[model samples]
Target: MFYKEIFSFIAIAITLAAFIPYIREIFRGTIRPHIFSWVIWGVTTLLIFVAQLEDHGGVGTWPIGVSASITIFIAYLAFIKRADVTITCGDWLFFIAALLSLPLWYWTSDPLWAVILLTAIDVAGFGPTVRKAYQFPYSESLLFFALFTLRNVLVMLALENLTLTTLLFPAVMLVLCILMMAMIAYRRRVLFA
Candidate 1:
């Protein structure tokens, strides 16, 4: 129990550490996050937090709740600041797909199914960000994602229930963040080369 609390706190700290810089960069107009991605992540993350709580996620879910709030704020900022408003057809497809998935999750009876649906949507939500990052490699923050990857691991470790619903999102996000960082690095090198 003590270890869970500690892990949760540390994970929460890392969430703030990661997002603070990304938020700072957004205000500085250095990092232009995709609005679609943020909205999907924010909504799904919040829903996942709720699912985790019901599934006995304990203190670990706190960071996810915190992240969801921050993510929604970032989405608002992205919309208002007009950061990367270049919406392509594919971007619209991703956005639309995310919207469509919401109903599926909402109708889901099982927490696991809801988490799975939301998690998949959250992952697919990466489309616009990945697309944008590929085109403008330096526009995204590598360090933020690195911290996120670590945070997800801590989140998993902090989980009290250890159920599939409780662990799946962070587990998947852990992999996604690593892959995202790798893709960004490759894009940076290729573009710079």
Candidate 2:
């Protein structure tokens, strides 16, 4: 049980690690808006980690403390530093998907199936969500969401021991991400008049 929890935590950490560059870019903006969203996700990740540790027993929830601190910093970025970025339609969609997945995550006994369901909904919704975010020239937002969806897909693959057929989803997502970025870039240049 403990190892299972550790595996999940590590998977999530690896996913977050992949986005470090994007996160840095977001912060480096003149005003670091969107920190709230980042911090909220971070805290949720930490809580999941803590809950796992508790289930494992005797480990305590140190990771939660660290995550709380990170969230505080994020709050400071969002509130104190005045990084108030507007949320796009896609961002709201992603948020809604996450919320909708909560019950499925809790009620489902089969973790793999549950993850697959979550990933499916995310992939289905992602294209439109990303396209909407790109409307604001929020390329980083799109990339960030893409990375997130990639992370979830990867997690499902890893946890489920999916066969070759499982590769389809990620391949499709990669293509979509590329095409979306290209379209956005092209429009940015053409529409700047």
Which candidate has the top score in lDDT?
Answer: 1
TM-score, per-candidate, Cα-based: 0.98, 0.46
Prediction 2 global C-alpha lDDT: 0.48
Regions of candidate 2 where Cα sits further than 4 Å from its true position: 1-18, 30-84, 88-94, 124-132, 138-160, 164-176
In model 2, what lDDT does residue 50 have?
A: 36
After superposition of all CA atoms, the RMSD between model 1 and the true structure is 0.7
lDDT of 1 by residue, 1-43 (tens): 8999999999999999999989999999999999999999999
Worst 10 residues of 1 by lDDT: 100-109
lDDT of 2 by residue, 68-181 (tens): 455456556666555545666666766576656655645655444443554455354444434443564554444554654555444434433233223333444456666656
Reference-based lDDT, each prediction: 0.94, 0.48
Backbone steric clashes in candidate 1, count = 0
Model 1 segments beyond 4 Å from truth? Answer: none
Residue pairs in candidate 2 whose N, alpha carbon or C atoms collide under 3 angstroms: 33-83
